[model samples]
Target: MAKKHKPRVKAPKTASPGEVMEIKTLISHEMESGQRKDRKTGELIPRQIINRFECKYNGETVFSADMHPAISANPYMAFYVKAGESGELEFLWHDDNGDVYSHSQKLEVA
Candidate 1:
């Protein structure tokens, strides 16, 4: 069964134009590395992890990261972005099983 993944973000809803702000994001995932065995059946667990992560602002790429098997479960990321204008921020996570999870938030600038 496929598990549902969810992304959480912490960002200011409003910011001053040209001001720098910190953005934090986290995604829920098991991050199975295929090296672990099931205690019940002693079967090798298939690897499952979010292989990539990206954040975009107004269709423009702002930040991205390449993930690996060594990554820990429930990945957490934090970055900084300069305030520009009112727009939407899009977050995307790519899984090894060809799955993509997305989250979006709106920002307002004065």
Candidate 2:
């Protein structure tokens, strides 16, 4: 059985008007690459990894990335975005197992 996934996000609660803010994200995942075999069963493991990642600010896409099996477990990403107004920042990670893990944060610009 697969373990539950936990996602973490880091962003400033407030930012200066039009200033660039750094965003960091990380998620717990095994990120199986499908290249190994079970020791007992001797069967090839299936590939299961976070295939995509996206970030949206104020309902608009800000940063996005396409990942592959080469990515390591517990993937971490850091990016930058311009602060706009008070709104929500949504982060999403899509896995090969049809699972979508998400997290959100509120940012206020002064």
Which one wins on TM-score? 2
Residue lDDT tens for model 1, 1-110: 35558789998889999989899999889899889999999999999999999989888988899999899999998999888989998899999999899999899999
lDDT of each: 0.91, 0.92
The true-versus-predicted C-alpha distance at residue 96 of model 1, in Å, is 1.1
C-alpha TM-score for every candidate: 0.90, 0.94
In model 1, the worst 10-residue window by lDDT is 1-10
The TM-score between candidate 1 and the true structure equals 0.90
Q: Total clashes, candidate 2?
A: 0
Off by over 4 Å in 2: 1-3
Candidate 1, position 69, lDDT:
85
Query: Once superposed on the true structure, which residue ranges of model 1 sit more than 4 Å away at CA?
Result: 1-3
Cand. 2 Cα-lDDT: 0.92
What shift in Å separates residue 58 of candidate 2 from its native position after superposition?
1.0
